[model samples]
Target chain A: MTGGARRADPKPMDVDALIDDPGTKIVVCCGAGGVGKTTTAAALALRAAERGRRTVVITVDPARRLAQSMGLEELDNTPRPVPLPRPVTAGGGSRDGQAARVSGDGQDGQDGQGSLHAMMLDMKRTFDEVVREHADPERARQILANPFYQTLSTSFSGTQEYMAMEKLGQLRQSGEWDLIVVDTPPSRSALDFLDAPKRLGRFLDGRLIRFLGPAGSGTFRLLGAGMNMVGSVVGKIVGTRFLNDLRSFVAAFDTVFGGFQERAERTYRLLRAPGTAFVVVAVPDSDAMREASFFVKRLAEDAMPLAGLVVNRTHPLPTGPGADLSAEWASTAADTLADTHPLAVAALRSHAERVRRRERELWLLERMTSTHPDTRVTEVAARPEDVHDLVGLREIGSALAGDER
Target chain B: MTGKGGTGKTTAATALALALATGGGRVLLMEVEGRQGVASLLGSAPLPYEERVMLSAPGGGSVSVLAADAEAALLEYLEMFYGMRRAGQALTKLGAVDFATTIAPGLRDVLLTGKATEAVRRREGGRRSPGGPHQYDAVVMDAPPTGRIGRFLNVNSEVAGLARMGPIHEHAERAMSVIRSDQARVHFVTLLEEMPAQETRDGIAEVEALGLRPGAVLVNMVGPRLLEGVELTAAAIGELDEVALIDGLRVVGATDPTGLAADLAGEVRSYALRHLLELRVRGELEDVGRPLVELPRLEGGMDRAALTGLARRLSEQGVRK
Candidate 1:
């Protein structure tokens, strides 16, 4: 009980200042699955666009969920303009309680009228594009048609992460928008987004792949006759057709493997570059906080520029019974009055549950603060209604900017 | 059972296992993610790949838990095959094994399904020891989330990755056979939220498309609607006299009711909104034509007592039957 007591509030993250600044170009929201990473990225993008910056948000969720929320029929691999409530001029305090200062310095190299665009990653389509662009006509067709290639493009574990990076790099190189917001895939570990490219790169060019390719294809066959004999025996078990499909797939893809590796490394560098910001989103619970803490440490270790943390769905205990009248005391008093006031009893019981939940949230918060000390943090209160539109996103953006209401 | 992340897959799977074990039948609770979520939920030590009995039900039945790691499972698979030390070295270096099991979703499902089915069919010696029963009458798997479940269980898709009509292909075919058979069931543990509900719908559709068995949908963490119909309507329409709630609060030890009244009103409003949302989700879930079970939100948090409470609910809800 003593350990869970509230402490002085930690420093709040200045999200408006971060987004409003002319220097910032990219904001990446990364977190564990179901932690509101997609929602956070969308809200941040909407906020940025409304603040008069040409901004584009990309989400890896295939549901076209963001598009539906923004009132658009659908969105694809290409960025489609999301209609804003108002044309954002060089006005101060535009939309909700957003940051008033829209930085006189023009980052978009256009008029101060802000624009927002959104797109959902079509991973296989993106991979197909990469192949079509990198490989020649004949080789690309062969690689794309291979049974193993089709499966790898579709169901391979890291394909989403790899395609996300590819798309991010492509979006940046296009120079269409001043700011880009990326919603990472809902991986169990935030670090998976960072390690995926490398893991896949290694897997693609590993010695095993080389050995697995047809023995007479290239220099990769170091195991010599012994390997072919083993392959033949396994071939008999799995059948020669399966072996031939895998070999042909590998042989055809061997040409474009270098392009994949180079692009992966390029994206890795882009993530760590200056002007790119990583925002870790989490809910104020033990599981969420633990994942957030790991994200903070990982970004630090990898030297990626982290903007701050956005703690979502926080419940501020109902504020009655005087500011000094702690939730604990109110709960105790409610317990004492349970016999006389039955309805009050129910309300108080609910209050007690809220108090207990708040204490646990605070405990997790305190641990996070103690561990990171210097990391900027902001929180969004739990909203009663689900957010699905520009208006709702603005409220969330306001909340992220420390409005709290 | 599995749903979206944070949909309480572990909780539902554990409770289902507990519910089944309540009838003097042995049950196996397994988690393949290695998150130790099952162990933490049961208030027990972290589970290794090896099986161990975690707790016993009031009905004199026991539930054992296992947390299987991919590396260990792959090694076990390899041991059954060549049993070559050099082969293990070469495979581990290239991570070809992990690739086939983890990175490659197709083969990963094959391995996971194979191991789980094995547990389901294992026969234990008649003699009982301190570790509890070696055999289980039933096995419950905490499966991958909806996003991956389709690929993870889609054996037909992965079978095309290699040559067909061989023993390896037959092995995968056998796993798929079990999945599609009446013996195996895939249930969904979801919340009333739109995302979860929609995902559940899509997942069930996918399962049906692949001709796999889709079981009941358990809606976990359904918050209670405290106020009655008229009270809720009054609250929603802002006709509920705040002064009345204030008076009710004042009758208690609380002298101040302004903040409390506002909070109370807000809670009522949210409750009304949530009630409607649940109705919509309920219709969608029912449309799936499978059994639907609604588990009340546990105010006491996910502790051992709460686990037992949910298990009891499962039993009453006819999930174990």
Candidate 2:
């Protein structure tokens, strides 16, 4: 089916089938802000674990709701086990007919067969940890202790993306869980997350380290004295101590540059690896779709595997013709209640406008998929009830499974 | 134009236009996205391009508004720059023009900046006409947000590495002249929120790197003073009364007056302290070395009264120039 027609034989949420596939490991959920990406990540993980696969979900949202949804008081970078229902399998058995419990240790274990773990990243803390992990303790401590480094670690300029990837790499290498699901921070441009690793990596490799490298030993230092003389003059005019402090910080981190560079390269490769899949999540809005399209094109350029697209909070148009209650209601509201209840009339009009906009968005998305055949599209109906607990998540999972709205 | 969204760049542009108009200098406010944010904020409909549509404020100032849609602007830009309609059609069909004009990262900035520059230059007597070419004394642009603002304003430098010698390169150089000149200024609008503040700081750094001086930093939606004097002192003390304190101590053998009052006071004190800390953080913004102004949050949404009040506050803050 094509051109806005509903798909025949809609695919239900097959957590077991997805977990069993060796090719699938990473599940990335992305969307505009306030679209429930954190809850979606929790639900997907819960569903995977319910199917008897050990799963871990990570969220980069600064909001505490991720921890709150999982019934936890707080969350840090480290993974914590989520208390699953005691009897393991829900509804008695696995629905996909796969083994309820695998017998291995690394891949899966006997009694710990079905488990769930979750982590919420403190981006700045994670960045600091990475520095401490890779660099000399003293050097890392010095950098961490620096006020500028502390600010830059948390400050904007494509740093959050780098930190997100760093956490992803840590989780991927941990071998602690069967499935890893990551929720990215709401970005101004969705593609920034994908481009972040490269942008930051290049900055570290090309400009930052060179400018900050040792003054007397490295190649930069040999040329540094002359540059410094000129820089001093310019720096005075600019009234900033950037060059001086930058040089010191770079010199301090120079010993660890090789390690940092290698790790960044590894992380970049892992993102492009076949085991990783990018699920571009977006709402059905003109601006959101525009950003999503840009993200898809960027992903293609990077050669990262596109798993599918999840269009979240999609307004379900009344499937049949009768849903056109809008036009008739609008006319009646206009005649009898225009001045008496303008707000009510206005709200009705807004709702109709929104429905029309959704139709257009669905059409555009259908057109996008036609050019790229492998890309699958899934729609999640807008939930009036907030998803804040396991029960709410189950409803969301059922929605994803294509249960009737 | 910056890449950062939701910043008050549009609002500042509109207010600045009003300010200049109030000072008896004709001004034009131009928007690139066709968003109607400026018009709506000013309580008017979307203004068409190249037309001097007047906007009247409660204070008796008149400002003209213009909305430059990308397609129409591109066609017009080509007509003016190349003096050929054929080039526009051929470029559009080839998709180079669209990509060059739209999908291009910095092109939007260039076009918006180019339009503002045209408005600025047109103020001087036209080559073919007598007297002052246009009535406007200044042109204000509600640029893109802070994230990409640097790249937008510095598109010429970004592309300079590629287009070294061409009409496009020449056009970029001309645009840069107006952008970097003293007559033109790019102001930034932000709230006191962590992310917006951080973005603003980085934006200042980046814009300076691109050799353009940022005009001012307008802190929009500034919180009103909610606590003061005796009530504030009482709240800070956790509602501890001297009579209750002594009575409770005598009856319940309560040794620590700090117990309930201390806990309550601690929470209130922390909340107040956090606001003070935010103010200190706002203070560090002074390091950017630009004029900083704060606009109090409107109790309601944007309307004529709020805009007038904001314009008055802006004048008091000395952003009227």
Q: What is the TM-score of chain B alone in each candidate?
A: 0.89, 0.80
Q: What is the TM-score of each candidate against the true structure?
A: 0.90, 0.55
Fnat per candidate, as a fraction, reads 0.47, 0.00
In model 2 chain A, which range of ten residues has the least summed lDDT?
A95-104
Predicted candidate 2 versus true structure: per-residue lDDT over A242-346, tens digit per residue:
345545666666666665556677888888887787777766644455556667777888898766666776655443321343433434443454454332333
lDDT of 1 by residue, A163-273 (tens): 899999888888877889999987656778888877777777766566677666554455566565445544654577866887888888887666556768889999988
Clashing pairs in 1: A93-A100, A242-B162, A242-B163
Give the per-residue lDDT of model 1 (tens digit) for B1-321: 989887878888988888989978788888877678787777777778888988787688888888887667766765666564455545676566656665665566666777787786566653345354548888999988888787777765576565466655666777777777898888998988888888899999998888888989999988755556676566567666677667767766455577767776665555555666777788988988989987877645577678778889989888663
User: What DockQ does every candidate get?
Assistant: 0.46, 0.03
Residue pairs with backbone overlap in model 2: B1-B149, B2-B145, B2-B149, B3-B148, B3-B149, B4-B145, B4-B147
Model 2 per-residue lDDT tens digits across residues B61-120: 577778876667666876776565665664454343444444333445566677778777
